[model samples]
Target: MRFALSAFAALSLSSAAFANTLESSAGALNITPMVTGLDAPWAVDFVPDGGFLVTERDGDLIYIADGTATRVAGVPDVAARGQGGLLDVTVAQDFAQTREIFLTYAKPQSRGAGTALTVARFSEDGTALENSREIFEAAPGFSGGRHFGSRVVEAQDGTLFVTIGDRGNRPSAQDRSNHNGAVVRINRDGSVPDDNPFVGQSNVQPEIWSYGHRNPQGAGLDLEGRLWTSEHGAQGGDEVNLVQRGANFGWPVISYGEHYGGGRIGEGTEKAGMEQPAYYWDPSMAPSGLMVYSGALWPEWRGDIFVGSLKFDYISRLDGGGVTEVEQIEGDATSRVRDIVEASDGSIWFVSVGDGAIYRITPG
Candidate 1:
């Protein structure tokens, strides 16, 4: 019966749990499970002392140190509902000295909730944060818990680039007057940058850096400080874009995807004055995390882009802008690859939400 087969499979997997490795076109990768039993971990950031700080979408912040996963206190209360919760984590460039940390989450409000960014100082013992404060809360706290695209990038200049999704409102992606569907820029203290694209414009939010994104959960800065983002489309048309200043990325106006019910969306994928995607996926991978790799680990992979796929349960390795996908790495443990980052030792680390675990990819 099916029960007998399921039991056999569980026994087989348990016996090989310690030696789980993923083999792909790249080669054999030794997969090490840093931590397990997480409630849908969203992202991970490394600290200076060989430890990791992680955020779970169910409103928990965890510290992985010396093979133990400990829940850290001081995380803000989150609207932990459908796709809304604590999402991304990042450390300050000078963390060894300042001990500052940044995170993005769905901040609860009376109207509903909105994506918000916060800054805090990590304690020395990795137990709690000090002086935590809300740095930026996206405008128009929405009613639904869907599409809070809360990815963040700490720019080289100490400024921040935060992506807020359209809050499930199809039309809001084209509305510049609100913070939804926009990449916002602000200083570390949450002050809007004077040179932002919409700073002096009327009927547009000053913090807007670029607008018209659908739900970009992936964001990263290239070596040259250029931002890149990957957004989820409705049915198909998942896109990877080179995010730029003062530019409008067509969303509802020009999508290659269709509505959930098979209806056409936008102006048929091309329109004047709207920026086209650097690349797009037709069948939809639900791309989440984005990272431009350095040659430190794989010399040939320098400048190669790695994006985690939520829908496809794989990692897509891409070339330069407008380039096609080169490869996808997948295995049983690579399910729902939510976030990807480069470690100090040059290994590629990613989180598997389906497994409630974190994994690392290194040269075989």
Candidate 2:
């Protein structure tokens, strides 16, 4: 029922099959297919052992072991509508001891659907998930099918940081009363951390770590444990932000890009008390899936930020402390790059929506 291509076999595939090699500033890279036959895979995360987990937007959690794909049971029901579905999957920090994993998806709700976080246990046999539990759900679910920024990141302190988009509602990003257009922080048990930015506030949602964002689809932590996010702009204002506690990222109120049609957006891009982006793409690269490289394989590229571009079909390597675009790794295999992650062995892996498969990159 599944086709699994081994790495050795993938390396032997001719250029006619896929882009076999890419030339980056670092060197020539061999792009090999790690797994194929995925249906709109959104995110990929490695397990402690030799296997990995992948989430399909259609709501299947597939575990890839020894080059085979097996559907794992116990995934929570997802909205599975336009732009809303199974999103990101992350292995828990204490996975070895707790066997826990985290997932972010568009959860069905009364008003419509909202981004939600769920905790589940990966059974010992790695074929099924057990004890699945919904931990957090963004507030005031919207009916729109766009902008569910649901990337899950495990912070250094073991807390989970989940990004929520503006849900196509501009003003809500600035409103603290709801989780819309916000990056929320919560404990694994779904409880608000006492030190959260808005905690104890009378009207604010305590889970919000930061607010005022459009559709931030990518998020990660740097070597220093600082949080960062990649966001989509309307026409040309995509952004990469260095997330901070209680900081307000001016979304609709200020943007480097204009609306869909040519028109000004938000006070000409600068506003008082609003944080500016670390880096932005004026022509809209449509960035998604962020990763802070440890340089495990390429020491020279340590501390660089790698982001997949859905619009450009390439991987962007940002350096100069995440404020500059140093290199663009592009190839036919990088079609509609959705998510990019580093494996334990230092190989870089990414999901391709256009190809409906996963590929790994290594120094050639």
Candidate 3:
């Protein structure tokens, strides 16, 4: 009877929340499941012509256009085990003209061990990657399976910002010489920008823009061209931060969350030189994808941050000064949301890490 009750509860929750409606002062939000049957979709990127490129982690392929899952033939072999494999995907700023797309994944090395972060560019030809080349790779890859910190954003000046995870090694976040736990800025041609924080530092990687981060899975630019990131914390210190150049975002050194077993994570929650988070969740919403909503579907939500929660299974609406309004969306409770992107037509699209379904939230 206990097992039966648990199963019934799961079914009821899944059925009730898979479709949701939000009636707010600005307007109504109708969230609908767009496409389903994906196997651990990791990221979703919008194409110029109203289609999308979706990455499936365990499957090691990029799915394109509607629910059609096509294996891009030239994708490199990935160590698709335990928090690794194909991750984030983003279209280049000049994607329409160049057909260039950026991808992040865990590149497999010897002994079944692998580095968690690598970025590459490929051209879209419907079947295989054309002129694909790796542009960035994490140095001294860690041994564990968690915290890849893979998100790519292109600035208006043609600079790329790539977030790297701390690889579950807290102390590595404070090391300026490594690529792990840092946000790196580079030109489209994979050259470090002169203005990068550590461009002239002796031991530091010139590409590093900012350092001391955990797992920054979500990154996007706002209307003002300022970069923003949402990162996963140990247990409760999930954070939303405004990315600033040369900023030190304290990770293991300072965290609001306790360790997984309920002990303090670091020395304190505040340090002198590190930048404080704009917002943090005590119980950890396990935030993944982030987007600043400027669409007409919910005018009041304009300039607000929309974050997808993986563990809590909801979408959090965050406003200025850390005020948050959480809406329990349907289907997310059973699905781990990997990424969220706003379409050019003002619709919000989200992908699940569990089954790789694509969902859209629009005005009802």
Candidate 4:
């Protein structure tokens, strides 16, 4: 069931080790880039059969089988401009029996106005989405198109972990009344969980699990069942944090990153009440997608975290416990990495935002 990259095509790039790289040698890693020429690929999810579903920012869902991509029809309309557009997608963990899939997109309102982060479920029948239903929608659509952190992961108890961006408003991140810039835990049916952090709080949405996030794009669960997320900071200080229930992560209030013009972001990098990041980067890689590798293909990388970077244009490898061993791997280096998914067979698949290509990386 495992997919193997041809050994004849091994390409090794110069090691651009960051502060997080392991001090000891961990053996060689060979990465081979497979498939090119896509149009802004945002996310990739494996189907029950051997194929995969790849979403494009320009409103296209491509079905790739045997390495050839075919466009699927009946995709809903998307804003498809600036930072808004068709975004992440995930197949239900019980997809083999249910054929259910979830998708996130920027729902367009006016000609130029839109609110990012809408989740919908659909049934797949070869080349189209059938029985599509919008499960959740962000409130108070914003005008500008930036900071739409829309990724979803199912928890062990069947609750859905949904990441929502700040909607270009920094103050809203601290506002408990709004859903922006917070991780919301809800039932799979889009209903707020009764046991949510702010369930009985006045003016606060019961779905808010955690708050004060600038822009969280990637989320995943470790083998220990701990939830982890990667958020983009202003100019520097991109972060990886272990998500805790009801924890407030300081965004504008505190950040290791300064403004693009070198202005102070908030009070400081650490505040008394706010939770600090588990790890942060200085240059801001603009991490988009995250996945933990426990696959057999890369035994040396087992239990490691693989993060796809948009600003750095590479893959960052981190040790399981936290951020340890950061190395920029080459594959679709010309494009921004959108999402990383470890296949059932242990091969890693990545989506490119710039060119929309889906690249499969395996041991060469």
Colliding residue pairs in candidate 3? 17-330, 17-331, 18-330, 38-355
Candidate 3's TM-score reads 0.88
Q: Candidate 1 regions off by >4 Å? A: 1-17
Please tell me which model should have the higher lDDT, number 1 or number 2. 2
* Candidate with best TM-score: 2
- Model 2, span 1-364: residue lDDT tens: 3445334346345533654887999899989787776788999999997689999999999888864667888899999999999999999988989999999999999999999999999998887889999999988657888899979999999899999998888988999999999999999899999999989899899999999999999999989999999999889989999999999999889999998879998788888999999999989999999999999989989999999999999999999464799999998888999999999899999999998888989897
> Tens digits of per-residue lDDT for model 4 on 64-101?
66644567766778878788888888888877777777
Q: Specify the poorest-scoring 10-residue window by lDDT in model 3.
A: 1-10
Best by lDDT: 2
The global C-alpha lDDT for each of the candidates, from Candidate 1 onward, is: 0.86, 0.90, 0.75, 0.75
Per-model C-alpha RMSD: 5.1, 2.5, 6.1, 5.9
Which stretches of candidate 2 lie above 4 Å from their native place? 1-19
lDDT of 4: 0.75
Write down the worst ten-residue block by lDDT for model 2. Answer: 1-10
Clashes of each: 0, 0, 4, 5
What overall lDDT, based on C-alpha atoms, would model 2 receive against the true structure?
Answer: 0.90
**TM-score on alpha carbons, each prediction:** 0.94, 0.95, 0.88, 0.87
Candidate 4 contains a number of clashing pairs equal to 5
Clashing pairs in 2: none
lDDT tens digits, residues 14-126, model 1?
43455467776557877766666667899998998878988989998888765455678889899999999999999989898899999999999889999999999998888
